[model samples]
Target: MELAIADKITQKPAIKRNVYENVTQQFNKASDLMDLDPDIRKILATTTNEIIVHFPAIMDNGRIEMFTGYRVQHNNVLGPYKGGLRYHPAVDIDEVRALATWMTWKCAIAGIPFGGAKGGIAFDPSKHSFGEMERITRRFTYALNGNIGPEYDIPAPDVNTNSQIMAWILDTYLSSVTPQERNRSIHIVTGKPIASGGSQGRDKATGQGTVFCIEQWAKDKNFDLNNATYMIQGFGNVGSWAAKLLKPFGSKLVAVEDHTGAISNPEGIDPDKLAIYVKERKGVHGYPAAEPVDHESFFKTKADIFIPAALENQITAETAPLLNVKLVAEGANGPTDIEGDGILQEKNIDLLPDILCNGGGVIVSYFEWLQNKRSESWELEEVDERLRKKVINAYKKVKNTSQEFNTDWRTGAYIVALSSIQEVYRTRGIFP
Candidate 1:
């Protein structure tokens, strides 16, 4: 059964889209709106550094396989470079560049002291055993030795990478330094196990932050979360956490679609139970709580809110028209393409753009970094409180900007971020 599941996971259809192009397109739209300085626009348009590495790792079968990895630093004017380390077969330069650029905007909108960077290894983590994964991760970390650090560039987890992978990275990076520098260097990675200096609420920070944005939206619109039905397009960390946290607000997760399959229950599905089933079964495919649905039906399912927590370009021009929801809270970066954004706007479906909607993860990541830097551990309650305050503040800013410009949420978010970045550049001026 597990083998069958693994095979199913690996058989996903190919999705082709230039994510970097998407980022630049959005940037150009916001830049035109704000009349951004052409010089600064040109500077922000390109990456600061693009590091690619190829290394060999021994598999459990004693076969040596070469792997490729990338770390793209987009900008660091605000602070040190910060982003996630993803592991996926589709990992490439364009995707990393787009995500890194998004991180710059995300951190700026969230008012965090960090710039943008992203790293990824182009391999399917599920195909490898624990030992093989450890070797590959350690080798990748070694390859990125000087490029990543506590005060320079920090890597967190994204997509197929998780806390365990981050733990490997933290250890491998620490092993290269002296004993005196070991404890302080644990900050090199943010999403490690709590025992390894990770923040208490880091695991659910992204999801919790998503819910906070939704809560603020609900409050402003006078929409009651109680009895609201939502469909989630991914059941991974962010999606599952959002569902679980929304349970308290009486939100019903009526439908869910993931890499494995889609399922729906009109009455409601228990997010906690489904999350457990997914953990054990590797997806939401075999969950008995909901009837199986196809991709089209999953999106067309009548619901109050839709959260695309899956990979990029899921909600495209084609899928946008099929959606039957009032709000879309982007849980994944770049889930909605440019055309889809226009379609959603035409449909009057309010959207919480990815940069603002998913900014919680980085905001909390900033908190974790501060905790490690200051040699302090915060309670989960404190972390949650801080995350709530920061996320709400960002949401308010985006909302105000949207109303101020009479534009959609995505452009509004970009304008807010670009204005902040432009202010910094104007104040600091360019270096020789």
Candidate 2:
């Protein structure tokens, strides 16, 4: 049955081109190509719920500050909603909606039994002290109340949020439930500290996953990663870990750019040294190992691969044309906008799309959840092996889909994800 409401809901375009629009545009393209059912398209296109809460937190100076937070549950046809919670001033509804939507596709592509959801507070965590941050996290968790649970929505770390913040959430959430539920509710959130039930290899999961995909690509292209030059856009967890893991593969980090500054070492900067430098300096600036480079020069520098592990839209149409690399492995969500994607496609740059490229975090999060639920702790070697297998499988599926559709990797990933969702909907039918 054709529903007018579904058509209207899916057809209406946003007034401005933003992250949500970018995701929707990609989704619509894949849906059209696959000839997806209209009803399912509508269901997948719209969010299941959008929760916005304003709460007060006591700051260090004894002043109460108001903070706004959002949690957008995109879909759960596959399973429970799962995603990360970011703490940044740019954490608005649109960005959260887009990220949640991507999480839906990301999980489906990875064949994980989890839907998509994302939440965030519109405050900069760097500006707050430890006590203030804890209070804010607890307050946000309290505000969520029954909206999040072990068997329902699960949030991990993203952007400014980390395992410490997740611990606060886990503790706060556990406190709200009954005694019997408290012990079993540790699975309420993933990415907690290892001492608190986090997986052994969870810290480097995202980077390792990206490396796995790259390894697969290298094999297919008969390209060698040994001594290959690469540049990274961010120096955070994902970028740093990716560089560190790739180091053993003989890949050299030639250039790096972060919020602090950009640096380049033509002979290749040592990933271990650069990582420590970033940790101490809070960014790549003043590393003393590499010469400083401007934003333009960073992208224009010659290299074999480019990893944009930073924020969204870092690679736009303007910047895409300047890239001299042969492949782009996105470690960040929505790093390339629609225009930027087009530019890369035009340039024939092989891309490991964000959904497949950066899926390791969630994949390991699944392991963490499983371990917590089963009262088991996996070793680092076991966790790494399992993650490798899962990520490589996802990469092969996406690559095959791209070949079948004669399209780019990004759209191919969406097609694979959407097809999975469509099949579920077709088999189960709609609820009354």
Candidate 3:
């Protein structure tokens, strides 16, 4: 069965559009171009399973609130379902489905043996106390029981979630499993603390991987980073680190935006100072150096490159037309929807697809997974080198494919990923 049909059967109506729909649309476009078999395309479009769990947790206000959690297993044809676990008030099954689908393509682009899946609980972690957060994570972990395994589905960190949440999940899962299953506890999850078997370089792996790709892209395009002007949307881990790394290249950091608001300075902002302020003050809104700007007007800023590191759907068709940047590096998943992509294409703006662009995190997660399985620790320098090679190779493959097809990078990326997935399906054949 095609994946899309399966998705329609499983998905409920009146829900926010599945983020994967954007992914599926891109896949279908490439599938049509390739004249792929309908059945195979369908199989690739839908998720294998979608698990939703609702549980009650005591709130700090002495109220028992029913929190809903979800895990969508998009595919396991390549390997285990590998993605991140998130915590946010707006998390829903559709979002997980979309995120899971992106994971499928990301791993394929990296030439890694991993499928896609994503899990999340609908709650604002920032509003909860530490004890409350732990309890919520533990309960969510408990609900999974034995459904999650190192060889089945592996979850990392995403959105409002982090390594601390993964730690709680690991402990909860370990306590619930049998003694025989406990030996492989470390393998069951990635993004834990170093002492708890997390990979040494996992913390900065995503940002570093992104830097490697950007550097390589600059080299291939003959674009000098020293003269490039950057406007980043999202000052979180990925954006902040990317800014810091690019600073040494003599790039001008023109502007940056977060949930609080956007801030800009045409002369360029110091990444080190911005990092310190964001670290100490929690956001970049109150930084005294840069002038406060309205978030709505951020798209109009003229710059060489715009990196969207925030949540998905930030740049729609409406916003795409307003963007004045020459290049867009998607540091977030599904930041550009299909319609928005069309506008960007019409405008001839270069777009770096999320599956290939922001895939550093999961690629590093794979490294983390391998380290745990081998019970070995690698040096940070080694980790950085390995990650750089992987990203560069992946970028090269995508670039070559784009040239071969004479299409934009986004379609070329889809073609490359879909071709791999189609080959996998053809080799596996049909199951009874």
Best model number under TM-score: 2
The weakest ten consecutive residues by lDDT in model 2 span 2-11
lDDT of 1 by residue, 72-138 (tens): 9989999999999999998987678778888898899999989999989999988999999999999
Tell me each candidate's TM-score: 0.88, 0.90, 0.89
Greater lDDT among 1 and 2 belongs to 2
lDDT of 3 by residue, 1-432 (tens): 443633663466656555556776777677777778888776776788989998887877888878899999988888888988988888877778777877888888877789989999988888889989988888888887766888899988877887788888888888887888786667788888888888766756666777777888888889999969999998888898888888999999898999888899999999899999999999998898888888667888899889898888888977998999878888877789888898998998887888888778887788888888887788888888888888888888889988888887887888888788889888989976
Ranking by lDDT: 2, 1, 3
Candidate 2 wrong stretches, greater than 4 Å: 1-17, 54-68, 88-90, 123-136
- How many clashing pairs in candidate 2? 0
> Which numbered prediction scores highest in lDDT against the true structure?
2
> What lDDT would each prediction earn against the true structure?
0.89, 0.90, 0.83
What RMSD, rounded to one decimal, does every model reach? 6.7, 3.2, 3.1
**What TM-score does model 1 achieve against the real structure?**
0.88
State how far residue 160 of model 2 sits from its true place (Å).
3.7
Residue 181 CA displacement from its true place in model 3, Å: 4.8
